[model samples]
Target chain A: MTGSAAAALQVEGLWKSFGPLDVLQGIDLEVAEHEVIALIGASGSGKSTLLRCINLLETIDEGRIFIEGEEITAKGVNVDRIRRRVGIVFQSFNLFPHMRVIDNVTLGPRKVLKRPASDAEADAMRLLERFGLAEKAGQLPDRLSGGQQQRVAIVRALAMQPDLLLLDEVTSALDPELVAEVLNVIRELAAGGMTMLIATHEMGFARDIANRVCFLDAGRILEQGPPAQIFAEPREARTRQFLTRIIEAGRL
Target chain B: MTAQGGPDATSRGGPASLPGSRAQRRRDERTSALRSTLVAFLSTFVVFGVLVYIVVNSPGWPAVQASFFAPDIFWSSLPGIVAAFLVNIQLFLISEVLILALALVLAVARSSTAPVLFPVRLMATVYVDIFRALPGVLVIYILGFGIPGLNLPGVPTDPFLYAIVALTLIYSAYVSEVYRAGIASIHPSQTAAARSLGLSQPQALRYVVLPQAIRRVVPPLLNDFIGLQKDTVLVSYIGVVEIFRQSQIVEAGTFNFTPYLATALVFLVVTIPLARFTDWLVARQARRGGGASGAASQVASALGRSRGGQAAP
Candidate 1:
C-alpha cells in the first residue's frame, strides 16, 4: 500500500455511476508529489471519469479523495477552494469560446485567486510566451488552430498555479501534425514537476513522459508499474490484450 | 463549348462556355432580372388598382372616408396624439427597465440548481405562470383598480404607476422565459469549464453563462420589447392618458375615428423601425452563425484594446 499521508493525490475506493452504467468502480490510486502518472485505457474505461472525480467536477457515488493529504471529498469541504489548487484540461480544449486566449488564462487567477487583472495578465502573457502562443493572446479560441487552443488550455490551467493537474486525452482530438505541439507542452510541464494525472491514448508519448503507467479496464485500475515494465511486460491478461491491440494499431 | 449530356441540357451553355458566351449569359441574366421586376411591379399595381376601384365604387366608401380619414380632423388631432405618445414612451421605457431587471432575477432563480433554492425557483416559476396566463389588460385593470381599492396606505393610487407596474409584471414573465431558453441553449460544458476553474456558481453565471446567454437572447428580448411597447396602449383602459387614450378622447369629442387612425400612424412610424432593427440584428446574428460570438468577439476586441492600454505603462 502506498503512503496516502504524503501523496499529492489519493483516491480510495472511488465509485461513480451515471444511471445504471458504472463508470468508475472501487478505484484506488495514489501519486506522490512531482509524480506524473499516465492512465491508459480504451474508450469506456473510466479514465476520464476518474480524472473528473479527482477534480470534483463529477460527484462520486462512494469514495474518499484526498489532495495534498487533505480529505477533499469530505462533507462541507469548499469545492471552489479545492478546485483552485487542482486544474483540469479537457479533451475538447474547452477554452471559453467567448474569451480571448489571454482572458482564458487569466480568468482563474483573477476570479478564483483574487489576483489583480494586470498581475494575472502579466503572468498569463509570460506563460503564453513560454508555450510559443504569445501572438495568440488576443485571439479567440476558435480562431486558433486545434493544437494552439489545447496549448492555451494547458496554459490556462497552469496559470492557476495548481498543485495537481488532470489532463483528459489532451491530444486525442488533434490532427496528427498538431498532436506533437500539445505533447511537447505536456512534456515541458512534466519535466518541470507539475504532478499531472493524464488519461491519454498516446502510448508512445505516455511511455516517454510518465513516471508510472496505469492500465484501466472495466472501471478499475487493472495494472500499474514503472512505464518500462508496464509497456514492455504488462502482467495482467487484459493489460496484455490492450497493449497488443494498441501495438497492432501501430499506436505504440 | 462541348455539351455531351442530354438533349434538353444543350440549349443552356456548359461550364466551358467561351468569354463571349459568358458575357451574353450575364446580359441575359440581367434582362431576365429586369423583366421579373417589371412583371412584379405591374402585377402589384393591377391587384391594388382593382381593389381601389372596388372600394371607391362602394356606396359606404364616402361615409367611411369622412369618419376615419377626414383630413382636417386627422391633422388637428395629430399634435395631441403625438404629445400623449410621450406618456406611452415613458411608461414603456420605465416598464422595460423593470422588466429587464426582474426577468433576469427570475431567470437566474429558475435556472439555479441548488437544492436549498427550490422554494425560490418554485415562486419564480409560479409568478411567471400566473403573469403569463393572465391577460396584460386584466393585470393592468386588477392592479390599477384593485390595489387602490385595497386602501393600502403606502401604495400610490396613481394609475400611471400601476400602468408601469402591470406592464412590467406581465412582460417580465415573458422575457424571463426568453432568458431561460437562452440559458438552456448554452451547453452544460460551459458551466463545467467555469466551475472546474474554481469559479463559484454565481460567478460562473455572472461572468460566463449570463454574458453568452444574454447575448443569445438579445434579438428575442427586443421582440418582447416591441410587444411591451404596443401593449402600453392597453394601459389606457386603466385611465392613463397615453396616446390611445388621447386618441379616444379626440374621437369622442369630434364624433369621428380619424384620431384613432392618427394613433395607428404614430404606432406604425415608431414600431416599424424598431421591428426592422430587430430583424437586422437577427440577420447579423445568423450571418455570424451563432448568438454571443459576434458580440463576444466585439467584447474580446474591446478587452484587448483596454488591456493594451493598461499594458502600455
Candidate 2:
C-alpha cells in the first residue's frame, strides 16, 4: 500500500540453485491484490522452490523480492517480518504433530504475532469452524483424515491473517476422493478475495480457481495468461505437451 | 512375532476350514511352544550348573569361599555398604539434574545455524569431543586432584564437589550427543513449517523442535543416568568414601572380600530395576511407532476438552 504502483507481491530476475543444479533461472513474477495465480508444472519444475524462496525458507541465489511493495530481499531486512505477511501451506500438511489441532492453528498468532492465548484460540476456533474442522480441534493431526489434515493446515496459515498465501501442491498427498474437500476450502478463500499463489498438479482445480495460470517448464515460465487462454489455447508446445500428458493420464 | 500373526491371518481368511484341522493346528502350536520353553530351561540350567560345579570344586574353592563368600562378613558389611550407597545416590541425583540442563545447552548450541553463533557451536563441539575422548576416571582424577591442588582462595577443596563436576562434564558430553541425535532426527520440514509461520529460529526451536526432541530422547537420557549412577563409585578413587571406598574399608578391617560382593549386590538392587525400566520404555516407544507424544496427547484430549467450545457461525 505504501508504494501505490506496486503489486501485492513482486519478484524480479529471481535465480536460485542447489549446489550443482539451478532450480529457478531468471524468473520474474508479480501478483496483484486479490488475484489468484496457479503455477502448473512437472515435479521438478521449481514451483515448490519458488514458493519456499519467496517465503525466505530457502535462500535465493540472486533475486529481489517484495511483499506489499516493501523490498523483502533488501540487505538486513527482517526475514521474519517479511514472512509474517506471507503464509504457506505445504503438500505434506506439516502441522506440528505434537500439538493439538487448536494449538497448531493458534501457535503462529500466539507466538509470533504476540496475541494472547485466548485471543489466538478464539480466532483459530473461528477459522476451524469456517473450515468445518471445529469438532477435531482437540485432536492431534494424525487422528484426522488426509483431507481434514490439509484443511487444518490451511486454517493454520489463515490464522496469521496473512496478506498473501502460498499453497504448494496442498492437495497432492490426499486421496482422490478427499482432494475435493481441500480444494473446496481454497475455492472459498478465492471467493472471499484472498490473494493466493498456488503450485498445483490439480489441473481442473487450478483452472477453476486461478484467474491466471502459468505453465512452468524446466525452471522457467514457458507460458502464462488468463486461465481460458492458457488452458484452452496454450501458445507454447511444451505447455500443450504437458496438458496432453495430463489429459492422457485422465487428471484433467 | 510374525508366526503369531500367521495363525490369526489364516483363521480369519478361511472360516469354513475343517474344525478337526483347526484343533490339530492349535494343539501343534501349544506343543511347539512347550517344547521350546522346556529346551530353554534345560539348556540354561545345564550351562549354569556346570559352571557353578567347576567353581565349587576348584582347588582354591575353600580359600575363595572363606575370603569372598563369608556369610558373617557379608552381613556385617551390609549395613555400611547400604549407608555409603546413599552418597552414590545423592551424587547421581545432583549430577543428573545438572547434566540435563548443561547437555541441553550444548545441543542447542551445536544445532545452531546462525553465523553469530558459530563460536558457540565450535566450543560445544570441542567440549563434547574432549570429554568423550578422555577416559572418565582420568577426568575424575584430574579435576578431583588437579583443581584442588591449585589451592586457590575461596575454592572448595572438597573432593565431592570435584567428583560431581567431573561426572557432570563427562556425562553431559554423551548425553548431549543423544540430544543432538534427537534434534537431528526431526525432519527439516518441521522447522520450515514453523519458520514459514514467521517464528524466529529460537522460537521455532523452543516451541517446535526441542519439545519433540526431548521426549524422543527420554529413554536414552535415563540410560545415561543409569551409567552415571554406577559410575558414582569411581569417585571412590578420589577419596569420596562412597560405596566402593566403604567396601574397601570394610574389607581391610575384616580381611575378607565378602564386602566387595555385598557392594555388588547393592548395585544390582539399585541399578538392575532401572536398566529393565529403560528397556521397557524403549520397547514401548517402538510399539507406538516412535510417536510417543501421540498416545499421551490422545489421552489428554479424551479426558478434557480445554479447547472445546461452540463453533462460530
Candidate 3:
C-alpha cells in the first residue's frame, strides 16, 4: 500500500509541556514513506508523548506535525481526519474488552469508514489472519493472551489502512515470550513496507528493524543516526551511561 | 488428694477406665445434638410462622372458598384485572425504553468535557437528584393533579397519560446513574484505543463505549425494570385503575378482601419471574467473568498464567 515517494511523516520543532514539566522541547524527526524509525528513551523521557503528539492524541503546546503533507497542527483542522490515516498501538494493547477480536478489529472501519458489515468482517478476518489471530475472531480481548491481544490491537489499527503506524511500546505489556510474537508481527509489517514509528525499549528489535534510531532524554532528542552508529559506537557520555545501565539491567 | 489421684491414675490406666473423659464426650455429643435440634426447630418455626401468617391474615378465605366454584367475582373483576395488566405492561415497557435512551444520552453528556456540556451535566445531575429524591407517589400526584392549567391541545390530560409520563421521567433519572456507573467502570484505555483508531467522539461512543456500558448495566437495568413494574401500583393512587386500585374497588363493593389477596397473588406472579430473570442475568454475567465479583481475580489469573508460561522458556 505504499503510495507516492514522499515523507510519510514530518514533525518539526515540536514543543510540548505539561504544566511546569517540559515533556518535549523543540524535537524534530522525519520518516520516509515505508520507513521504520525507532524512538528509544527511558521512562518519562517523552518518547511516548512524542508519539502521541504525532497522532494528535496529545495536543502539542507548539510545533507542527504533518502526515502525507497534510499539516495536523493547523487550526480548525479535523483531527479525526488526520487520525484516520495514522494508526496507533498503545503499550497496554487497549483492545475493546467488550468486543470480539473480529469486532474490535473492524469497529473503526465499519463505524468511521461506514463500510458494510460483511466487507468490514472480511477485511478484519484478513488482518487477524495476518496477525495469527484468525482463530480468536470470536473471542473477547480478555480471553486472549496479552501477545494475542496486542497483535489483535495491531490488526485493529491495520484494518484502518493507515498511511503511517505509530507504535507506543506495543509489546511492552506482553510477557517476555509473547513479546517476541508481537514484535515478530510488527517485523513482518515493516518488511511488508508499512511505514512505522515505534517507541520501544526492545533494543534487538529496534536494531534489526529500524532504518533510523533516535535517543530521547528529558524531552529532547539526544542523538539521531543509523542504528549501527547509535548502538555500536556512542559519542555522548550520557548515551554511553544510559546504554550501560540498560545493559547492566539485562534488558538490552 | 489421694482419692483424686486414685481417679486420675485409674483414668490414665486404660481407655476403659476413663470416666470423666467418657462423660465429657457424652456431654459434648448431647450438646451438639441439642444445638442441631434447636436450629431445626427454629427453622421450622419460621416456616410455620409464615404459613400461619398467610392463613390467618388473609381476608375472606371462607368467602373465596364459597365463591370458588361460582366464578362470579372472578369474572366480574376480569376486565379490571386485564386493564390493569395492560396498563402495567405499557407503563413498564414505555418507561424502560425511554429510560434506556435518555440514560445513554445523559451518561454521554455527563462524561463530556466540553464547556458547553457543563449546563447539560448540571441539568442531568439535578434531574437525577430531584427525581431520585422524590417519592413516586408525590411525582404521580403532581403530574396528575398539579399540572391542571397546562394541557396540550386536543390531548387529554388523563390520569393514565400522567402516570406514564411521571414514571418515565422518574425512572429515567435512576437508569441514567446506572448507565453512568457502567460507562465509568470501563477502562479509559478503551476510549483511547477507539480514538486512536480515528473514531470521532460520537462514533467511538456509539460503537465502543455504549455497547460495553449497556452490556455491563443489563442486570441493573433489569432490576430497575422490576422496580418500575412494582412502582406501577403508585399510579393506582391517581385513579388509574391499576391492580391495586381494582382490588380496592372490588373490596369496597363486595365488603370482602379476597380480591386484595388475589391482587397480591397477581403481583407475586408478575414480579417473581422478573426477579428470577434478574438473578439469572446476574449469574450469567458472573459466569462470563463480566460482573464485579470475580472478574478481577479471573483477569489477574489469566495474566499471571500467561506471564508464567512466557517466563518458562
Candidate 4:
C-alpha cells in the first residue's frame, strides 16, 4: 500500500529533450494521494512529454522522478516494477488488437504479477462487469466502439491496481458523443480516489472534476491551484490568455 | 460460358427465338462445345508435331537416340534414382527444422537494440552477410572438406551431417531476412503497448510481435523451404550419393544419358507436393484476408454493416 505521508508522484527539476528540441524544461511538481491534477495547455505544450517522463517511457535528460518516496528514475531501477505501479492509458487506446477484451485486461496481472489464470480471469470479469464491458469480454478490441475501447483501456490500467495513473489525452481521439462515456468513466475513477495526472483539452471537464488545475506552457507549469482560484481569479497573464482563447473557441 | 440468350448472341442473331425452341438452344450449345474441344486437341497436336518432326528428321537422330533417349537405360535407372531420393528427403527434412529455428534467433538478434547485445547483433549481421554472399556449393565444399580437414576432436566426419550443416548455415541466413522482414512489418505501437503494461521487451516479442510476425510470413517461409528442398541436390558436390549424383553414376556407366532424365523426373515428383502445399498456405492466408487484423476487421465490418442496417432511419 502507498503510505499517507508521501506524494504519489514527485518530479524535481525534470528536463527532457529530443535532439535539437527541448521538450520539458525543468518541470517540478508533486501530487498528493487521491489528487486529480489536470494538465491544461495548447497543442505541443509538452503535457504528454511530462507525463511520459514520469512513467519512464521517455529517458529524461536531467533530474529525478520519485513514486511513493522512492526515486524510480535513478540508474538501474527495476523498470518493470516501476511501470507496474504507474499505469498509463494512451490517446490511441492501443489495445492488443489480436487479444480478447478479457485477455487484454488480464495480461498485466497474469504475466507480470504471475497470477493464476482463473484468478486473473475472475478479477478481469469483475472489472469488465463494473465497466459495462462484461458482454465484450470474448470480443476483440476492434469490435468495440471508440468510447468502449477507451473505457477498456482505462479498465486495463486499473486492473494493474497502480498507485498512480497517467492519462494522456484519453478522450481526445473519441467522437463528441463518445467523449461523454470515457469522461464518465474517468469521473467514476476520480470519485473512487484514483490518483491521476491527466493531460486534457476538455477545459469544462477539467474544471468540473479536477481537484487542482495546472496550466502547462512551453514545457513549464506556469500556473497551478484549485479550479476556483485558477479559473475565476487571475494568476499569470499567459494563463488568462489561454483561458480567453479556450472561451473564444467555446471549449470552456 | 455466356448465358443462353446472352446479349451478344441475341443482339447478333436478331430474333433467334423465331427458329429455335429451348431444345434447339441446348443442341447449339453442345455443338459449339464439341467444336472448341476439337480445336483444343488439334492445337496441342500441332505444337508438339513440329518439334517431333524436326527432331526425327535430323541427320544425327539415330546416334542421339542411342546415347540420350534410350528407353531401356531409363527403365534400368529408375530403381537407383528412387533409392537416392530417399537420402535427399532425409537431408531436406532435418535441415529444414534446424534452419527455421536458427534463422528466427538470428533475425531477433539482428533486430535487438539492447546495448549489451551489440556483439550478438554484429555477429548475426556478419553471419547473414557472409553466408548469403557465399555460394551454396562453396559452403558445402568448405564444411565438407575444410572442417574435417582440421581434424578437430568431436567434429563430424560423416558427409551427410556436413551437408546438413552447410545447407542449414546458408539457408538460415536467407531465411533470417524473411523473418526480419516479417518482424519489422509489425507496428512499433504494438510493442510499446505491451511494454507499457510491464511486459519486458522479450516477453512482448514472444507474446505480441512473434505470433503476428510468424503467421504473416508463413507463405514466404514455405518458399524458402521449397528452395532448400531443391538445393539438397547441391549436397552431392561434397560426394554424397543423392539423386543427382546417382544419376551421374548411372550415366557414366552404359554410356547412356537417359538416367539424367529419370533423375530430373524424380525431382519434379518431390517438388510438386511441396509446391502444392505452398499454394495451399497462400490460399488459406488469402481467405483469412492478409493476417490477424484482417480476420478481426472482416468480422468488425460485418458487424458494422448488420448494425448499420438495423440503425437506419
Candidate 5:
C-alpha cells in the first residue's frame, strides 16, 4: 500500500481471535490525521478489540497496523514505544487506584519519558486544569465521581501527548448526569484536532463529534461512512436495526 | 437499636422501630442476652475460674508457690533476666530487617511472568511450600546445631549469628506468602494501566503495584513479625542465653521458679503491644475503605475538632 501523508493510522487486513472465538476479522481502516473516527457496534461485535489491536494491547493473530507510516506489528517494533505513542483509555477508567490523581497523570511521564518530577507534575497539572479538575490533584481516584475519574484517565493519557488516542467506550460506565462531563472532555479534544479512534455506544455523541463512523457486526465492519450517512441512511439492515433500538430507547 | 428491642407492638419503646412487633423484638433481645451471658459465664468463669481455684487451693499450693511464684526470688533475679532480654531484642531486630528485605524479593520474583524469571519463581514457590511445611523449631535445631557442628573453615560458629540466620530463613518463607497475597490481591487493571502508559513490567510493579500491595499487607506482615518475636525464646535452646535461658538457670541454681514467671510476664509485655497495633491498623484500613462508619465517624469527628482547635489561634 502507498503511504498517504494524510493518514495517521492505517490497518491492513487485521484479524484477531481468542481460542475458538474470532473477535476481529479482516478489519481494514485508514484514519486521516486529526480525524475523529467513532466505532459503533452492538456489544460483541469486536469494536473495542479493534482499538486494542491498534495500540498493541491485544496482539493480532494476523495482519499489520501502521502508525504514521511506521509498521507497529512488525517484529522488534518496540511494543512499549508503540504503546506510548498510541495511548488507550478503558471503559472502566483503570486509574492506578493507589496513587493520587496528580501522581497517576505524571507517572508515565516521569517513569517512561524520564522527565524530572517537577516537569512531569507541571505537565500533569496543566492537563488536570484543562479538564476542570485542578482541585482534585491531591485526591485518589476512588474519591472522584465516575465521570471525574474517566476525565482523569483521559488527562493521564494526554499527559504523554501521544500521536494517537484509542478511547474504548469511555462514557459507558458513567451515570447519565455524569456522562456529559466526560463527553465534553472528548468534544474539546476533538475540537483541538486530536486524532482519536473511539468505540462508543452513545449514538448522539458519535454524530456530534465523529467525522466518520464504522458500524461493526459479528466481527466485521458491516457499514461505515460519514456519521450523517451511517446514522440517517445506513446501508445494512443490521445497522438499521441497531439505530432503531437506540431510537426507541431514546438514546439516538 | 436498644430501645427498639421491646417485644409487644404497643409496648415498644417508641416509633424507632415500626417494622418488627415489640413482642418479637423483646423476645429476640431476651434470648440473645441469655445466650450471651451463658457463653460468657461458661467460657470464662466456670471453665477458667474454677480450674484456677482448684489449683490455687490444692495441698501442693505452698510448694508450687515456693517453686514458681516466690516474689523475693523474682525481684532478686530481675537484673539477670533483663540483661538476657536485651540479647533477644537484638536478635529480633536484626532478623526482622533481613526477613522483610528477603521476603519482598521472593514475593516479586514469585509474581513475575517474564520467561527469564521462570526458574526464580519456581524456586521461590518451592522454597515457601517446603519451609512452611517444615516445623520452625526443627529448622532451628538443625541449623542452630548443625552449622556450629560443621565448624567449616572461615565460617563463624557464634550461636547469635546462627539463631538470626535460622529465624530469618524460616520467617521469610511465611512473610513472603503474605507479600504475594498482597501483590496478587491488587487488580490486574492497575498493571494494564501502568503498562499502557509505557512502563516496563518491573517499573509498573515498583511504581504502581508494590506500594499498594505493601500498604495492604502491613497488618498481616506485623502478625508474622510478632510470631517471630515470640519465637526468639527458641534461640535459647541453641545455647544463646536469652530471657528464657537466664530464667531457667536461675530456677535450677536457686530451686525457685519466680524467674520463669517473670520471663512469661515480660514476654506478654512485649507481645500485647504488637497485637494491639495490628488490630489498630486493620481497623484503620477498614474505616478508610468506608466500612463500619460507627468507628469511622468518631475518627472523622475527632479530626474535625482537632482542626478547629488549631484554627482558633
Candidate 6:
C-alpha cells in the first residue's frame, strides 16, 4: 500500500487528430493515486477521446502517458503492459453479448494475465459480488438490464485489478432509474480509493463524488480544480456557461 | 306512436324492393362475373402450358415405367448412388470446416490496421473476386489440371480430391465475405470494451468478435453450404463419379435417360432439406427482431423500451 503514494497516471501535452479534425489539442492532466477526477465536456469536446488516449485505445498523435512514473510514449513501450494497468468503461456497456457474465469478467485475467481458470473465476466471482451481480454470473450480457450490464462491465475491468479505471459516461445508456444503481457502484469504488477518471454528464455525481473536476471545451482543458471550487466558484466565462447550461437541462 | 312507426318501416322496406336497387345488383353481378372470368383465363393458361409440356416431353409412358419403375435398373445403380452420396457428404464436411477457419482469419486480418494486414486484405479481396467472378466449372478445371505435377503421393491423383479442394477454395472466398460483413456489422464498441479490459488485439478478436460474428453469419454460412452441395454436381466434368457422373454412365450403358431424371431426384432429395434448414434459421433470426445486422439499432430500441418499462415501474 505504500507504493500507492506514486501518481496513478500522468498525461502531458497530449495531442490527437484525425485528418483535419483535432480531437485532443495539447491536453495536460494528472491523476494522483486513488483520486477520482471528473472530466466534464459537451459533445465532441474530446473528453472521451482523451480518456481513450489515456488507455492507449486511441494512440495519441504526440504526448507522454506515464503509469507509475514510467513514460509510455516511446517506441517499444510494450503497450499491452501499459494497457494492463489501466481499465476503461464506455458510454454503451459493450459487454460481450455471447459470453456469460462471469466469463466476460474473467476473460482478461485468464487470457492476458495468464492466470489459471480456477483463480480467474474465483476473482471474477468476488468482483461480481462486490458489484451485486453474483446472481447473474451464469447469464449472458443480453439477459441483463442495462444498469446490471454496466455494473458487470465495471466488475469485468476491476477483475484485472487495474491501477487506474477510466469510465466514459458509464451510465449514459441506462434508464433514469438505473443510473443511480451504476453511480452507487462508482461511488463505492471511489470510497475504496480506486483511481478513476470519469467523463460524465451527471452534474450532481461529478460535483459531489469527484475529488477534482476538469472542464473541457473544444478539445482543450479550460478549467480544472477541486469540485467545490470549480462548481461553486467558476474561474472562466466558458466554464460558467457550460455549468449553467447543464444545470438548466438537469432541472428540465 | 306505433301507427306512425309503421309508415317508417314500410318506407325502409321500399328502398330494398326498388327498381334502382335491382339495377345496381345486376351491375355488381356482372363485375364479379368478369373478375372471375379473368382469373379463370389466367389460371387455365398456366395449367394448359404445363400439361402440354408434360404430354410432349413425357419420354413415352411405357418406357418410363420400364426403366424407372423396374427393380433391375433401380437396384443395380444403388451402389453408384450410395458412393455419390458419401462423396457429397465428405465434400461438404471438409469444405465447411476449412472455409469457416479460413474465413475467420481472413476477416480478422482485413479488419486490422497493421501494415502487414495489407497483404491479407489484398489476398482476401483477390480471392473473393476471382472465385466469385469465375464460374465453378472453370475453378474445377484449374484445380484439376492447371497445377502441373501436383499430385499427392500414393493418392492416385483422384479428381474427387481435386474437386473438394476447389470447392473449399471457392466457398472459402464467399464465406469470407459473409464473415467480413458479419464482423463489420458488430458495434465497434464491443472491441473497445474488450480492449478496455486489457485484452490484446488478437485476444479481443478470438474471444469476443469472432464468436458474435460467427453467430450472425451462421444462416448465410448454411446458405453457402447449400450452394456448395448443388455445385458438387459440376465435379462430374472431371470424372469424379458423383451422382451426376454416375447417372451419365448409367445413361450411356443402358441407352435410357431415366438415370438423368433419377440424378435430379437425388439432388432435390439432398438439397431441399438444407435449403429448408436455412429458411428456418433465417426465420429464427428474423424473430430475434430482423437479424443481428442492425445491432446498433436493436440496442438502441431495447434501451428505449427498458427505459419506458422502468418509468412505469
Best by DockQ: 2
Range of the 10 consecutive residues with the lowest summed lDDT in candidate 6 chain A: A1-10
Give the CA lDDT, 0 to 100, for residue A3 in model 2. Answer: 43
TM-score of chain B of 6: 0.70
RMSD of each: 3.9, 4.6, 8.9, 7.6, 5.7, 8.0
Residue A121 in model 2: lDDT: 86
Name the 10 consecutive residues with the lowest summed lDDT in model 2 chain B: B296-305
- Model 6, stretches more than 4 Å misplaced? A1-5, B1-83, B146-155, B290-313
Interface RMSD of each: 3.0, 3.8, 8.9, 8.2, 8.0, 8.7
lDDT of 6 by residue, B1-313 (tens): 1233556544434344444454456778899999999999999999999998886678796676666665677667767876776777787788778878887776776678778778878877777788889888998998777653465566557787888888888887788889888888877888888877777888888888877777777778788888888888888877787787887888789876667666677888888988987777666656776534334224333335232211011
Looking at chain B only, the TM-scores across the models are 0.89, 0.87, 0.71, 0.80, 0.78, 0.70
User: Model 2: which residue pairs collide?
Assistant: none
The DockQ of each candidate is 0.54, 0.56, 0.22, 0.24, 0.44, 0.24
Worst 10 residues of 4 chain B by lDDT: B304-313
Docking class of 5: acceptable
lDDT (Cα atoms) of all candidates against the true structure:
0.89, 0.89, 0.81, 0.87, 0.86, 0.80
Native RMSD of candidate 1 (Å)? 3.9
Q: What fraction of native interface contacts is shared by candidate 1?
A: 0.52
lDDT of 2: 0.89
Using TM-score as the yardstick, the better of models 3 and 6 is 6
Error of 5 at A147 (Å): 1.5
Better of 1 and 4 by lDDT: 1
- What lDDT score goes with residue B234 in model 1? 97
Q: Is the docking of candidate 2 incorrect, acceptable, medium or high quality?
A: medium
Clashing pairs in 6: none
Superposition error at A222 for model 3 (Å): 1.4
For residue B302, give model 2's deviation from the true position in Å: 16
Cα DockQ of the candidate 1 complex: 0.54
